[model samples]
Target: MSDIRINISNKTYVLAHDTEQFHHAIADLDFTVHPQQFVCLVGPSGCGKTTLLNMIAGLDPHFEGQINIGQATQSPTIGYVFQNPRLLPWLTVRQNIEIVFDDKPPTSLIDNLLDNMQLFDAQHQYPERLSLGMQRRVSISRAFAINPDILLMDEPFVSLDAPTARQVRRLLYSLWQKRPHTVLFVTHDLREAIALADRLIFLSPSPMRIVSDIEVPIAREQRTDEGCVEAFREQLLQNHPKISELL
Candidate 1:
């Protein structure tokens, strides 16, 4: 197994704005994400969760720290799925997903993802032609099509209705099972975190230091139902008392 260690040590950030606020976004944070591990970042709003994620994605270079993946000096290939679907209105579902492929991806791979996302029937449909949930599914497909080593998801299901969100969550979990990747998911939803994470990292508000790093005890293969999800949710709540008040 490839050992994937995502190290963020003594990382501090000071805003460039007039305030010049001194914030240690991730203070002396050290966590090793083994290959194919699913990790989730859970915290209150404005907890610098996204800031930490951005640093890992190499989107914010002004921070004081080092983020290493394996032994390579260069950053790993990343695929990001944001809160909004962010699909192109001009393109069909197939075209949108295909755009992510730098070189031509295997047709079978694309087809399989479309089927898994329940987007096979809507392959020729434009973004406007699809519903919000469908568009999000397309976005998920697009992200996975790139075959990234690290997948960064920032509240990808936050905009959907409860039922739709649950469905998408299942789809995402299934895809992760098929093609295991180093995933770093950021969400305020405790249920979502418990349902998908192999390990959970809880951050404090403001400066956003790592408050808790927990290994979820549930087995991934059995986490396919709401009962199993709720069980883990309760476990998380029990472990982190602060999360209950925030949620």
Candidate 2:
């Protein structure tokens, strides 16, 4: 795993029948993510957050830019966790995770992941039988199972209830601690970003461009404390009044 370099001059989409009508999703967006660094892309809804992730993940190649993962000739492995747990409904929890592997997966690693995520017992259950939180856990487990160089997550905790989201967040942090992969997580929620990211990259509304990149000073362990998180947020807003407007 190495640094991720991205430079996008412009990313446009056709809006209507008229050739002149176009929507610029991103413009002049340039940034680099250090290896094993956790950075959150924070912005208002529809601010091209997902589009940027798509480009980085190589899911969309129509944009005008260069996205290079590492120095190697072969592209690095990428793990993506979408907004929803797109698990196979018919497969059991364990099977869903195993399918990501082309050949036989390391049983020890799979078992460790299952034990850590508390999915060991539920591994036999189908997606429908599990709660939304459990399903998301499976999605996360599957992503990490690949041991990818980069991990891209898109609001994996958006629709969960408060407590469940908190639990999932904790579990994610724990997993990252064990094997810290380069992470680019997308979310509109500033507080959530503050809690999980080592740095926060704020973007403008549509035709999104970099507005601010603030390094988080609070220790990751201290972020769980709401008071500490709130204080950092307040201080950040005070330092950069412009960022508050986007949120």
Candidate 3:
């Protein structure tokens, strides 16, 4: 198995304004993420789940520790999908996705993504013309256009309505299955975590620490079935009661 061992030892962070009041965002977080594995980070609000993700993305350099991708060194090619779509209003759907590709991707690849995302008909539509869910779909397509080795997503489906969110989740899982990159997804939604992750990492309240690292035994292909999804949901609630309350 291709595994990325992450050993974050004795790492602590303090607010920029309050140096003396140290907040232990991540305290001795030691875990390994297998390559092509889908991992989820779950915790209460302000528990520093996103902070830990930022550290992995190499956006925050102040923390003291090491985050090894596969070897001892770090991996620079990382793609991020934030809570908001963050698409350019002036650009059309095709243009937005094409932006990630410096040169054009093969016409077939672009068309395939657009069709899979259900955005093919809206290719010429600008962000302002599409609904919020459509815009987010475009954002997701754009993120994958670069084909980064690692993908970091922070609650990409949190704001959507239930039906739309579920649809997007299925799309995301399909995409991840096809191109298995090292994905670290952060979310408070237990169902979302269970539906997409190969392993689930739970964090404690503020000054987060690794409370649990549970493997999701269900096969990726089986996740779309209603029975499998419901079972996973029940298991998540039973296993992580504290984390459930945060959602």
Q: Best candidate per lDDT, number?
A: 2
What ranges in model 1 sit over 4 Å off?
1-24, 73-75
Better of 2 and 3 by TM-score: 2
Residue 203 in model 1: lDDT: 77
Backbone clashes, candidate 3: 0
Tens-place lDDT digits, model 2, residues 126-150: 9999999999999999999999899
TM-score of each prediction: 0.89, 0.96, 0.88
Ranking by lDDT: 2, 1, 3
TM-score of 2: 0.96
lDDT of 1 by residue, 1-247 (tens): 3455555555566667678777666666666777788999888887777877787777887655566776665556788887888998998999999997678767998999999989999999999999898988998898899888888898888878999998989999988888989899999888888889988888777565677888888777767677988987887688778767554
Counting clashing residue pairs in each candidate, in order, gives 0, 0, 0
Best TM-score among the predictions, by candidate number? 2
Candidate 3 TM-score over all chains jointly: 0.88
Which tens-of-lDDT digit does each residue in 1-247 have in candidate 3?
2466666665566567745777777667778887777899988888887777788778876666677775546444788888889998888899888887667556777788898889999999989989888888888888887777888998889879989988998988787777768899999887778778888888888656787788888887787776887887787678767656666
lDDT scores of the candidates, listed in order: 0.81, 0.92, 0.80
- Lowest summed lDDT window (length 10), candidate 1: 1-10
